[model samples]
Target chain A: MHTFADPLRYASRMAPTKTAVIDGNESIDFAELHRRCRLLAGGLLALGLDKGDRVAILASNGQR
Target chain B: MGVPAAGLVVVPLNTRHAVTELKYALEDSQTKVLLIDRDPGELADCVNHVILIPDAYDAMLSAAQERELGVDVRESDLAGLFYTGGTTGKSRGVMLSHRNLIANAFHYMTTVPQREDDLMLVMAPLFHAAGSNGVIANISGHWEPRSHWPRSIPRSHSI
Candidate 1:
């Protein structure tokens, strides 16, 4: 089954340089967003977090 | 977003809720990690780990390796646990699966005309379902912060 990451993966593949998100003066392309997501996921994994684990994010809307 | 990509369930807490409510939601969901923008006072003890935004959050991302995308996420796997506003009664945790959110995205995109060059202004808090789903619905579109709405809206002549 396709997860939420599919669109990003597909977008990055189709247009890596396409701007995916823009917050204020900063903006990231599809490829960069996908890359950061992977790196963040890897970081979580390195913390021993696995499937079914619960993660909470409390931050305002922004590029970060 | 990264949480679900890693095959973990996300429990987005209402920032406006009181400490009592926050404590209840966290305990009810049994959250493993809490990534907050600031100190949550006594609420910090509710989760196993608390990663502060910007600083600790950035360090966490930079320190670890990249995770392989879509490892073992099933359609039925729980993606998030959204808590109700408790306006009617006690707050309840609304369980949503990967398929559910993806379906919502598809449904939203189908109903709303989204173009490749469209720019979406995110005015609502990302913790809200509508807010988060809005972002997911038009993944291909450029997302601008709400602060830029005043100047950005007029530029989008098509809208």
Candidate 2:
């Protein structure tokens, strides 16, 4: 099965440094965003929490 | 992959809420581990765990590596529950599935004009269906999506 990270990796490899997200004065490149998604994915894995175990996120628009 | 792999159901909480309201949502949702955007002192008294937003969250995701989530996922299994405001002053859980989401994504794309070079400005809050769906569309379409937060959007050549 394909992981959620696939599309992220595809974007990064296809566009590399292309700006993926821009929030007001802040911006994140595709590569950095992919890394962030991966890291987040990793962090969720590290929690020792089961895959389907629910994690609630309450951040505003930018954080997602 | 985060919540998708989770047989664990995820419920996004509303930040603009009172302790009691937040407590009710947590308890009703049966959130065993609570991850908050920021530390809510009041929530600490209710939830067993409270995760601070931004830095702490970024670190979690950044440091997160691919590991087995150890849960069985099925096509018909409930993916998430979207609560809607009701006449009884309570909300109803709208059971949604992975296929429901993926199918809807494909259906919506058929109606919308998506170009590889399109850069979408998502001005809605993440909690809204439109906003959340927009994120999904942007991701699936491989188009650059900008979030309007705090405010302001800049001009771009190719988004």
RMSD of each: 7.3, 8.2
B1-159 in candidate 1: lDDT tens per residue?
A: 667877889998888888888888889998878888978798898988888888887898888788777788877889899998999987898999977887676656655777778899999888899899988877733332233223322332342
Using TM-score as the measure, the top candidate is 1
Name the top lDDT candidate.
1
lDDT of each: 0.79, 0.59
Off by over 4 Å in 1: B140-159
**Clash total of candidate 2:** 16
The regions of model 2 sitting more than 4 angstroms off are A1-6, B5-8, B66-77, B143-159
**Which candidate gets the maximum DockQ versus the true structure?**
1
> Looking at every candidate separately, what fraction of the true A–B Cα contacts under 8 Å does it contain?
0.79, 0.52
lDDT of 2: 0.59
User: A-chain TM-score in candidate 1?
Assistant: 0.92
Candidate DockQ scores, in order: 0.58, 0.46
User: Model 2: what is its DockQ?
Assistant: 0.46
Tens digits of lDDT, candidate 2, B1-159: 246544455666666656666667666666556666665766666555566776666566655665433135665666565555434876555666665654455444545778776788988766555666666657655532333111222222243
Model 1's TM-score against the true structure: 0.89
